[model samples]
Target: MYQFDKRIVMTLDAGGTNFVFSAIRSNEEIVEPITLPSNGNNLEKCLETMVTGFTAIKLKLPEAPVAISFAFPGPADYVNGIIGDLKNLPAFQGGVALGAFLRKHFGIPVFINNDGDLFAYGEALAGALPEVNRMLQEAGKNKVYKNLVGITLGTGFGGGVVRDGELFLGDNGAAAEVWVLRDKRQPVYGVEEGISIRAIKREYAQLSGDLRMLSPKDIFEIAEGKQAGNMVAARETFNHAGEVLGEAIASINAVVDGIVVIGGGIIAAYKYLIPAVMRELNGTLEMYEGTSVDRMEMKAFFLDDVADRDAFLVSTSRRIMVPGTTETIEYDSVKKMGVIMTRLGTSKAIAFGAYAFALNELDKC
Candidate 1:
């Protein structure tokens, strides 16, 4: 197994707008980063830019980097380190064999993964989950949360899952691709239509009936400033998004039951989003509450004199009733699943994740 202590690797964070290059050590310390335009429309220029950036960073390091690792947006084969038909960068319509190409040129092992997956992995290892577990320990709770689901709300919605401290890629490296799931209310639209920056604007426009193209930031400013006519629309938009997100989380919890860490530019307005999400989740818990038959009988006896006994029984039937126990049953609730913002910013999280992933791969060799 490779010892990660003091080891350094070349890391890249590729996005639609820019390619950020830097050297990061095992301890998550990052060196100066060089930012270059992604040259996204031209594959040749994009490849050249990445090579040039890494070469420059390599020259500055005292020792050659042990490997190269990066987080790339995907619709491609992450297992094979190929990027497929990136919609934003049309020049990559013919998939790029990124890992092999980089390894050949740099003469080192190269690792690549979906940006969202790596972001979640970083949070699981060094950011949100660790912080949460620490807090749990400090508060004298025996429970430690290891699984996590991370979501990014930017131009689009992206999601990833981590289980037991490792990224969960599922059978085809597409386990947590939550954005593609059909929307609960609009079957024609995917979940991303309700969770993205565009979604926020669409909701605001629908609510306010003003079709002028407005960014999420603009809507946020109006809402935060309590602008008379626009605030209600903006607030409703966020709250609706949150409720949709909560439903998505409930579905995810049914499978993974993990904590959630949210990131991306949209999270700047988390103050408006989180409460609505919590309210929806809490409501769902109440809706699914488990009760005992004895407890129901006790309630029925107490309410027999009441005029509204039938209505109370109808409401009580919604809860799952266990037999032979008058005592209140303590059922596990979904609300126990914590949600928090990412402690590590996007770039740092991606960079550190790439570095850690590279090291883990090296250890196996």
Candidate 2:
């Protein structure tokens, strides 16, 4: 399904509830995306589902894909392509050698990384950090150095780090695993703790004595309307999580002057809880006169409108790497062709392609 003239890269972000996949050509061209239920029983089911998805993608491409990349949930051994134990995703425990399997089956290079790290990479490469840096430079401040952090408040807290414009994977690849803190200790000490959606639901059931909740979305909606007597508890829960996040950012700031690029479904309630978070952060960080903490300086990303900005960033990056080539041409042509693949959405496909592209690039090193 791939074309002789076009290159293909696949990326996937496997979550607890769902697995999102994308096949992109370069940074701009999206080749469609596939979504399937995430069965975490083991690597077998995941591999089966992925292979099937790849087959479907092949039908539309002109030739075999050039490379593959993945952004997997939980702790990932990116340097060696081995996955670590993930709590919610039962199937991924004891690690998965995803790269070796993909290579054996497809005869192509494959690269994989943590989902949180990919999000951070995208943000640092294209998101809030770039904008902030450009603004600072234009104002005549020595271009702010690249110490960055990205946090995702989804099924649980996910975090990643970047320093000097590159992803900083520590000696063990677990450098930014900040969400594993225990709830009681985290709340009191102002440290960020990762709270699963399931935990929130359990809390609601305990307080209201109703065990028939449909989804986190429904629960939050009702709580927002104050229809379920769940608003108080939900607000407390979110605020506590936000406080933890802010405290963590403060700790991170002590070490690096990086912007915190936040994303994920849980961040949807950002507006509701950011105030408390900001308050806690300010309380802790007020003494540091050099840290930037003003309203204009610290801005949260709105995923709705700021959507494909990451695509633009990635495209720009691809252009930078390939000098003398008109970047616009690559972006426009690839974006047009890739969007033609399907209707699933951009994030899935872009992540897939980006992952694939990353793997191919790493192989050269």
Candidate 3:
């Protein structure tokens, strides 16, 4: 396909372990994306590297993208355009003036958001939340839905909340830190520490006292086969996870009633474990006949190139783009890190995409 008047938007997901960048032309079509190992040990040095890389990517733009949206693996004062003390990302602890720095250099608007928050917002705008919402709407008058909770289990767990169609970050945009599950039973450890994939492995091994080593994948396989020792161990460990997860969700439900959507590699291993999770959640609910325990609805998202998944591209195009506007086409099949975001340092592109989205929405207001 050939085109004229093309507009490019770049998005970045700078994570602790991996950084991915993607360039989207009108949502579906990708011009390029790149991925790289991240070394966020030093803030100024990493930002410097990012700037250098972005310069190179600009040379290949299909006519400089309209905006950029960046997702950083840290705490950010999104309203003020400052990165706060991100515990996992030591380099950005004190805070980075990402917005001013980008604007002075590129003369383009940029937007920043917490990766988990953006992930959930984008999912609702474009991915799994829609499916879950549809199911709730079907549940009819009994439905008490008001928000969207996204739980992602990757290197660690990522929690995000969406209320009334917008990312609800509370005063500081940190409302979705649901991984900090306080288990009185465990006393010392939080939920992430006790039930994350890493924790599950340690608990399983310690209880079994098996000298033989096993990967998390192996644990799931053993659980699937219902093997005697492994099943007993797996059931015990995962049931604890479900209980912790249920508690977290129940607490959130008290504040903002909504469906919980759980994703991530670990959950993929044992899809059947949700039943145990739902059972545990039932114990937490104090229903008086009318309300009863129901399975928490879950959905999986594209694990790769998540930065450019265009959660709102389809909806935006349909609502805003002109009819017969073949000049711009959207495709969601390609799965690769954007060139600028991953290798050439395209954090600006990400910030730009997000800014564009925010501006567009603001205009509708």
* Location of the lowest summed lDDT over 10 successive residues in candidate 3: 336-345
Top candidate by TM-score: 1
Residues 285-338 of candidate 1 have per-residue lDDT tens digits of 323356422211111111112332222222222244477866455443222556
At residue 237, candidate 3 shows an lDDT of 68
The better-scoring model by lDDT among 1 and 3 is 1
- Give the TM-scores of the predictions, in the order they appear: 0.83, 0.70, 0.69
Ranking by lDDT: 1, 2, 3
TM-score of 3: 0.69
Q: Per-residue lDDT for 168-279 in model 2, tens only?
A: 7789878777675445424553133334466556655665666775355655765587456567666665665556666566565555555666666655566555655555
328 Cα displacement, candidate 3 (Å): 52
Please write out the lDDT profile of model 3 over residues 9-72, one tens digit for every residue: 5566677765666655533436455665556777777676556545555666768765556676
